[model samples]
Target: MAAWLGWQIESNWADPFVFAIYSLVKPLAGALILVFMYAVIAKDGLHSPLFPGVFVGNALFIYVPAVLAGISWTIIDDREHYGMLKYVYTAPVNVFAYLIGRGVAKAIVATVAVVIMLLLGTLALGVPVRLAGINWLFVAATLVLGSAMLSLFGILLGGVTMITARHNYGVGEAVAGGLYLLCGVVFPLDTLPAWLAATGRVIPISYWLEAFRRALLGHGTEAFASLSDGVLLAVIAGSTAVLAVLAVLGFRLAERRARAKGLLDMQTMY
Candidate 1:
């Protein structure tokens, strides 16, 4: 799985340098868009206090969709593009474990993307990141815990796509996009409608992002102050545990259905 993921990244471009550049450029562009949007709205250039919030939000936001699409698309890639589903299905190795490996690879990629965004925001865009004031221990804890939760969520999405939209990779993309909006990536959850804000409360990303910002920025925002740090961590950890179990169950069900319907190797008009 590690070798396959390495090949996946390397095969994307002709040169290793180009691939590295592409990875940095893509996330940088995403971070810049939100930063500049905030600048425009505030009419105060990039020096607003809100810069850190937007910066951290966009930087971390890249992981949510990237992880989901990475794991879910690998399913489409193997089953549809490479026509290797039959081989994969018949393998003695556990399929859930295979999916977890793919998710880990994607999580590593997302970590690099986050680093690139942080560098770009601080070095290029002049977004203030007070490195000296950051609580490195808490930040590290938030990142590790948050990544695990997001990866498990990705595995769950992969299982759902396998059962419902095996041939359509766009389903993965669409689900990620929806989560981006509903997860409060760019804006505060309060900005959303009452129902949407309520919905965001249940999603782990909301708590994860809030805890992330508090750890990195050294201050908690009002949006997430109702929950203590312990509570936030508990939610993230508890949700991840629950999602891991669901992902395993979901994969089993999806596998059974695919086999029963003869859809494991079936190619459809996607």
Candidate 2:
């Protein structure tokens, strides 16, 4: 029900056709920035061996901002925009489940954006992802495990937003931007300083992206090129398991604080 509500709210702004067009355009515009950057520096341009990984990486990264910020945005949207959060508390629905549902709704939308990006990247940009060469299992596992990890991260951020002020709308996006820099989205982590490379290695999304690239393009970036596909999947699953515990515990504490301080129903006019 929460997922249904979230979809309705997200799609109500435009009709289906227009919404689909908007979705396709938004990601492409972002990709063009990377395309132009590569064109300027690479002698091989879009045909370079490295271009496929870069193209697929940036294309697949739509989920990070969409899912990560989308769930956190729910807290701000319901409490500040609709002012219906207090009613949500009074209702019988479980808050954790509701947030998960909301995150799933965003993931569904992100999936559409991802498919569109991948298709366009293949046909228009020559990303070189042949269907016969792709690993469906890796793609499926990465999407499921990666989305779950991101949802937990989103819930953790939503918990923080539950207690913060209305002006804190940018919190989730800031975190997503930080991850973009640290997670080897468009470039290899090896390009960064040693300390930053170490930090990126610890992040689960780093492994997730590596696996995703290999699934689509038959290989990944040089950052984790030494590890086999199985090792990368293992790291993603293990890290997500650890994140699940922390997200749940942190959200509970944040909820307790919000309820005790009367922040759930409190609205700042900012």
Candidate 3:
């Protein structure tokens, strides 16, 4: 699945040079946009103390679209494009496990995106990541827990896409945009309106971003300090557990309904 995904990402350009250039350009362009936005707002170019936090936030934000689009489109691709949904449904293999494998593949891609962002930010944007002070173990732990939560969230999104049979790309974009605003991807949650802040609280991405920034930046604000590593990990674990159950149930219900409605192989209008 991972190999297939890698091919899908780079298969458009037959030339290896062009493919490699685009593979770097796409994510690096995203990082540059965010960095430029920050510079414009701060009027400090790359010297803003907030640059590192914003860069890190924007870097990790790559996961939102990667996992969500990957899972949702994977479903859309198999069912609508390839017309293989029914065969997979009838097969002995677990469908959810297959989805997880695909999600892991996307996660790997997202990790590469992060590395690209870091390198671009440090070398080109002159954003200081302070690698010497970062706690590698804590970063690893936070990434594992956060990735689990995000992957489960992707599964939930996939299940919803299966149920609706709507444009999965639109659904994925909506969810990713909402998270970008409310999940503190490029700013602090406290700066948001009261209602927005409240909404951010329930989403695991908010906590994940906070914990991750703390680990990578080696400093914590009062807001982040309010929640210990133990508390953050607990919330992430609990959310993943709940999301897992919901995804399974949702996927099962969607499969049953599609079978009943004879929509498993239905052609997508869009």
* For every candidate, C-alpha RMSD to the true structure in Å: 2.1, 1.2, 2.2
Assess candidate 2 and give its TM-score to the true structure: 0.96
Model 2 lDDT per residue over 94-196, tens place: 9878888887778888888888889988998899889999999989999899989999999889989999995578899899888899998988788889999
Candidate 1 off by > 4 Å: 3-13, 165-167
Cα deviation of 118, candidate 2, in Å: 0.8
Model 2: residue 212 alpha-carbon error in angstroms = 0.4
Q: Which ten residues in a row have the lowest lDDT in candidate 3?
A: 2-11
Full-model lDDT for every candidate: 0.75, 0.88, 0.75
Give a tens-digit lDDT track for model 3, residues 1-270: 644643564354467667556556777887778777777877777787767777888888888788766777667777778788778788887777777677776676577778888877777877666789777888888888777777777777877777676666588889999999988777777788989988988898877787777777776444467788779878877887887788778778877877788877777767
Most accurate candidate by lDDT = 2
76 in model 2: Cα distance from truth in Å? Answer: 0.9
Over 4 Å off, model 2:
none
**What's the residue-level lDDT of 5 in candidate 2?**
91
Candidate 3 deviant stretches above 4 angstroms: 1-16, 220-222
